[model samples]
Each structure stands twice: as structure tokens, then as C-alpha cells.
Target: MGNFLIVSAGQSLREALSVAENNGVDPKAVLDMLTTAPTLFPSPIYQGHGKRIVEDTQAAPFRQRKIPLKDVSLFTKTAQQVELSTPIAHLLSDLLRSDEARA
Candidate 1:
């Protein structure tokens, strides 16, 4: 949910909401919908140790490549273009870039 909050402030979400608003969708109504939606994860973990950690370590390099930095950069770029604030997203993106394990 917290991550979603960050994502919701990112470029992709900013662009999407702009489109929604252009189509007669009210921004406040969209937020209200979210407030009314059922919660899927009562408690969510951002980082988790999965069952195959040992096995997964062998493919760590490949795994890192699979994470979409392109999307994140694009999101940040679009946020700037749209004049929307995305501090959290930008922070996450910066952290992602610096993490050698992820990079």
C-alpha cells in the first residue's frame, strides 16, 4: 500500500490520471474509489526472503536485468513533464540505481 502510494505519484500514474480527468473522471472520485476498495494485503512486506533464495542467487545477474529501470526513468521523466511531484518515486529510483545488487 505504501509502495502504491509512491507509484501513484509517479509518472505513469500521473499520465494515467491526466487521461482519466480528460475523459470526465474526477481525481477526487478516483481517490475515493481507492479508499473504498477492499484491502488485499493487510500487511505487506517490501522485501522478503523467498523459499528459493539459494537457488535464485545463481541467477542474480540475470534477475537484476529483469527489473525495469526504463519504466522508472520514464516515469520520472514524465512526472517532470507533467509538473507533478514524485519525490518518493525519484528516491526509489535513485536508490535502485545505486544498489549494486540491483544495478
Candidate 2:
């Protein structure tokens, strides 16, 4: 659960780091390691959140598949309601909607 929250809320975390840095705080050491997990336990976390599988349910071909963005609009709306800046959520929502429009 902790890993999910920390890894999934990437956009919000970046915004937080920006705010912290602007206020003369330094947390580069902590921020630098979010990309990959430890060598021992690497596969599971990546397979779940970071993998972009073929979205067969969509009309597009296998080559056209993208990351499965789970209900980004609802998630972003909730983020806004909570005064959170989730730029990734908005971007994913826009991308998904545009893809739908293209189909």
C-alpha cells in the first residue's frame, strides 16, 4: 500500500519537490531513487504500475496500445477537490479522451 501510494502519486510528488526546492530545501537524495526499485525486488512493482500492456479492449491494434490509465478523470477530479495538483492525471485524461475521439 505504501509503495502504491508513493509510486502512483508521481505528479503530486514532483509538484511537492518543486515547492520544497523553491523554499530553499534540498531533498535530491530522496527524490533520485523513485525510478527503479531495489535489485532484489524489482519485477512485481514494475509489472503492475510501469508496464504498458496491449489494451485489447480498445479498438486500436496491438501496436497502438498504451498505458492503462485507470479512470483518470474521476481521480483528477478528486485530487482537485482535495487541493492537490495532479498534472499527470490531467494529461492522462486528455490523452485517453483524445484517443477515444480518434476512434
Candidate 3:
């Protein structure tokens, strides 16, 4: 099984919650629905000269060019340069644990 799945940008939290409530789904189930559904908000892109675009495009085009999460490699030398936030650190730790478990 894959370690992670990319969600598109068409699903909304309200819709997810409604589905969960109607289906009596668990928290994980709700999370799975949210993760699998398209994103309701658009990702922001910053251009030079203080130009920015928000939700300007659909995620379908990008979704067509997905890379497996398992293939993501840490920059061994420069990973330390990134600020370690609680959530990001936890995700990295989880990925490492998943890899070790698979091995």
C-alpha cells in the first residue's frame, strides 16, 4: 500500500463532515475522505514583482503528473536548513517509521 495519497482541490470540509455524519464514519474514515477528495481551496503561487495567484488553476493538471510519496528523498546535506515545525517533523518521522517497518 502507498504511504500517502495526494488530494485534489474539489472537496470541501463541510461536505466531508456531512458525509461522515451521515455515514457514521470514524475519524480516520473522515480523514481518508478528506485526503482523497479534491481540495476546496486553491494553492497559492507567488510570482516576482509582488504578483500572486490564488486558486487560479485546477489541480487536475498537476494530479496527472504525480510522484509516489515513497520516492521522496530528503536532501541529506541541506535538510537541516529547513525549519523543523512540529507537524512537518512529525510527518517526516512517520515516513521514516513507515519505511523501516516496510523493510
Candidate 4:
């Protein structure tokens, strides 16, 4: 799916856990309920972190977006540069690669 799936899923999961907690349901029970869904957790990938690739091309955008200046002191007169780490960088790269790509 187009990147937002993971973010929306996270928000939904947080809300679910909050509700469960409010009703005194154990958090582990909530995770157990999720694992029972065949479609979402068909395999054991949920038990551990999944391996993924990070190709040189994938890192290209980060290199291109690198800040030129070094970090300056808080009270210094010089302007400082800040770097951000986006969780959906790979998805963003795919989305921005073409002119006709739909979001």
C-alpha cells in the first residue's frame, strides 16, 4: 500500500490499546487478539523484526538532502542546520520518481 497504511494502522492500534486499557483489558490480550486475525498475521513475521534491503540508490536522496553547514551552538549568531529522519523515505522516493504516479 501507498505508505499511509502503516501510519494509519499505528494510530488505529494506539486507539485500540487505549480503549482496552480503559476497560481493564490486558495489553498482551490485545496483541493476542491481533495475532488471531489470519489475514494480518498469517505468518510469524510479527514475532520479530523483518529484514529489508537498503540499496545505494535508496540512500541517494538522503545524501542529496544533506545539510551543508555544521551544527552551531544554541546562543551563537550563526544559523544552524537541522536534519530530519522520515519513516517513509523509501515510499516518498517512489512517489516522487515519476510525474504520473498517483498518491
Q: In terms of TM-score, which candidate is strongest?
A: 1
lDDT of 2: 0.44
Please, what is the whole-model Cα lDDT of each candidate in the order they appear? 0.44, 0.44, 0.32, 0.35
Preferred candidate (lDDT higher): 1 or 4: 1
Range of the 10 consecutive residues with the lowest summed lDDT in candidate 2: 53-62
True-structure RMSD, every candidate: 15.0, 11.1, 12.3, 16.5
lDDT of 1 by residue, 1-103 (tens): 3333433333333344447667898744443443333632222221111111222433422134224445566777777897989786676576556653544
The ten-residue window of minimal lDDT in model 4 covers 66-75
Local accuracy of candidate 2 as per-residue lDDT tens digits, 1-103: 2322433453344444456557776535334344346533245443322222212213222223133344455576677888999876666556556755675
Model 4: colliding residue pairs: none
Cα lDDT tens digits, model 4, 10-102, are 334544555776789875566566655564543343222111101222232112221211111111222123343444443333333331233
TM-score of each: 0.39, 0.38, 0.23, 0.36
RMSD of 2: 11.1
lDDT of 3: 0.32
Relative to the true structure, candidate 2 reaches a TM of 0.38
- The deviation in Å at residue 19 for candidate 4 is 0.4
TM-score result, candidate 3? 0.23
> Distance (Å) between predicted and true CA of 44, model 1?
13
